[model samples]
Target chain A: MKIISSPLELKEYLKGENNSIGFQGSKSIGFVPTMGALHQGHISLIKKAKEQNELVVVSIFLNPTQFLKGEDLDKYPKKDEADKKICKLSGVDVLFFPHVEDIYGTDEVTLSAPNVRGYVLEGNSRPSHFNGVLTVVMKLLNIVTPTRAYFGKKDAQQLNLISLMVKQLFMNTQIVPVDTVRESDGLALSSRNVYLSSKERVEALKVSSSLRAASSMVGKNILDSKEIVKEMRKSLGDLEIFYVEVLNLDFEQLLHVEIGNTIILVEVRVGTTRLLDNIWL
Target chain B: MKIISSPLELKEYLKGENNSIGFQGSKSIGFVPTMGALHQGHISLIKKAKEQNELVVVSIFLNPTQFLKGEDLDKYPKKDEADKKICKLSGVDVLFFPHVEDIYGTDEVTLSAPNVRGYVLEGNSRPSHFNGVLTVVMKLLNIVTPTRAYFGKKDAQQLNLISLMVKQLFMNTQIVPVDTVRESDGLALSSRNVYLSSKERVEALKVSSSLRAASSMVGKNILDSKEIVKEMRKSLGDLEIFYVEVLNLDFEQLLHVEIGNTIILVEVRVGTTRLLDNIWL
Candidate 1:
């Protein structure tokens, strides 16, 4: 596996890979972009891409723009040498490790969100967060030039926005959304999950538990959104409930359950670390 | 030359192009995205791309989102067959002709500008215009993964935004900014120029002339921005003056001309069509 640090260098290397070999007599590229601190969740995305494409490239960068001023950006995990080792183990063909200056410049053109969609749940707490995420994603998509790209559904809203961007912009790559990988304790995996204290770790399960509880209630035909939130808040007692939204897949509020189209999302403060999770029905 | 009318068809064709023996190592894709009515200016852009890349693709799409509600969208030029002929004559390899439905869907994700940079100049008049431009450009860039994309400097602000999007988004293709093509009479060529009456045509030259006059003053070391605009408005009398700004290349208004870095732009109404021109010093 090659560790490519600069965007330009990775692009040049990818270009060579694209030109040198043929994909079943034609050449095609696959890409997976991550924020470093790799786990089984990221490897899952890469493994699938490797199975399908002539070439596979993964990017590992801890984007500062995505984290709000008080968020875990400063304390976020960094395991560069270990990450390279993991990439090699996971069969990643190319690794893109770009610096801050390589990804952004002064007086840049930025991406903003729809006023309605961008200011709910996670976006509400960190107002400018999605803008940063979308901007960086757009940049990465352009740099990789993948025939298909992989994204985990752990960040459901982000996956939705990326799909929306690809559709709206007529981006040619296929966005393959993989299911969220979770721990044995039913905790959804995240790099930020490390910030949780042992006590906070126990409290954080309230997020996934509430989502599961909501799923059971919908199965029992109790579909009212307000009723669902009421039950969720009770289960999440003592934890600061940011929001427990039952939104349609589009993130629009739904008064009743719409199976396969609803997402029950939860966010709460477990110590100083904010944890987010959702169940897409 | 092949005329691809739907996104599905184009995607399928591109996929085939991606995986076929004859496709690999055969060509570089050059792209020209336009709003249908192929004038000399657009032809110049297409011609330039043709010269640079082995396979040229031209898209004639009068993107609806880019036009404000009260703008001339209904009356926007549509020379479809003529545009096809123009591309054919210019040696374009493919003509991507997608309808509105082919490109946009409901509840689409949008690309927004930086709050400060996006709300000035043409964006001020058509508040949602740049977002629309950026969104469509993102789509088009994805749809036609050209080795290089061609744009005109006549829409200087649009070119600036596209360049910014390409850079900020880490898109792999290079942005080839073709110089603003002009009429022999010194009027900058524009598809909208057709909307102008003969009288308005003569008046429209004021935009270019004012930029020319401002450039000469900046050449002679007259650095005051206010004085430059004041002189420009005088030369462009009887037109509804929208704004006359002397700013840097980044679109920030300069208090004084910065020798090699200033751009004096003028926006004024020649009849109903708003014309813009600038001198990049």
Candidate 2:
């Protein structure tokens, strides 16, 4: 797989070399953007992308603007060689590994997240985080111009906001959300998972378990949102809970969990690292 | 010209009917976005578009968001039939006339103008104006997906900010800066010119004349910015002048007018109507 760093080169490369890898059919590029250290979650996203299109492109950009000042941006895992190997093994057509300076400039024309949906849950905890996320995602989508971009349901809010951006901006590409990847123990896989210590690692399981409880509650016909949230908060058992919200597809607070339209989310601090997990019913 | 009101219909129309009006070869689209009172200024843009590309699209959207709360949004000139005739006469392939509802939504994902460049001159006077302009322009650009988009230099700051946005966002379309078209009497053509009474119409000549005086001074090697600004202000002669300053192409204030790299901008109120005129040195 060819790795390109420049935005212009990637745009032109995406345009002119449509059917380069001998998978010739109706031309399409499925894109998966990540902040490197490809985990099972990223691989799962890549797998969905590969299945859907003639070509798959993965981007590994450590977008700086998405992190808050105290957030561990510098310490975010970067398995560069391993990421490249993963891309190769997954049959990625091209890898976009851009530098911070290359992607951003001074006095940028940035994006603002939606006022209502953007201010709740993840956006609430890490304010300006979604703005950075959206700006970088927009830049990446413009650069890639893929037929379909794959986003995992693990970052449900990010995925939702991105889909909204594409719809609101009238962008042509489709945003396909893949199911969240989880470990055998039910902990959602994340790049930040590497930051957890042994004891913290065990504690992180609470996040997934709570989300699982929400799913189980929904399965057993416990439709009231207040009851689900109450039980989810109870399941955490003294962890640093940021929030446990039962929201609709639009991210609005829900009184009752409407099956097939509900997303139950959890953000809790396991040691110094924050863990996020969710169940989309 | 086929006029389309829906954004989806327009995108599909622009894509599928590239060669419908019977101009062939490489399939380039030149777009000119306007606010519906098509005068010589818009005709000039359409003329440029026709010369350059195989197809031409003109959007006549009087964007409500760009107008401030007390501004003349309701009273803005709307010569719908005349504008349609102008596009048909000018050989425009399509005319996009989207409604506010079709173009914008609740708590939308929007484009913010750059902090420094976007907060001066017109942006200063009408705060959040450029943000609205950029957001609508971004929506239109995405919807149309033109090969090259045209803007008038009469709205010099608007042109600069749009170019900056396209560059900063890594957008693919080329932004062509069309020279401002003017009347034989030297009044810059504007749809808002309709608001001027017979007396204010004559008084409005002072705006362009101020820009001309600055230009003539620069031509004679009077390059000092302060001196040029002083003379321009004198030329305005106690009218309701908003700002009379010389700045570089980057919109940063300049100590000296560096010939090809300078712009002299002026905004003044004549009666109850605001007029803007500028000269690119």
List where candidate 1 sits over 4 angstroms from the true fold.
Answer: A22-30, A214-231, A252-262, B14-23, B88-91, B115-117, B211-234, B244-264, B279-281
List pairs with backbone clashes in candidate 1.
A23-A26, A139-B169, A139-B170, A142-B171, A169-B139
Q: List residue ranges in candidate 2 displaced over 4 A.
A: A19-26, B18-26
Clashes of each: 5, 0
Under the 3 Å rule for N, CA and C atoms, how many clashes does model 2 have? 0
Q: Deviation in angstroms for A235 in model 1?
A: 3.0
Q: What is model 1's native contact fraction?
A: 0.65
Return the top candidate by TM-score. 2
Q: Chain A TM-scores, all candidates?
A: 0.95, 0.96
What DockQ does candidate 2 score? 0.55
lDDT of 1 by residue, A1-281 (tens): 88877888877877777667753443577799999999999989988999998788999988888888887788889988888998999888888888998898876777776576777778888899988888888788878878899999878878888887777777767899898899988899998888888988998888888888888998899999999989999888899988888889788899998988988888888888777788888
Per-residue lDDT of model 2, residues B163-224, tens digit only: 99899888868999999889888899988998999999999998888888888888899999
* Alpha-carbon TM-score of each model against the true structure: 0.87, 0.97
**lDDT value, residue A9 of candidate 2:** 89
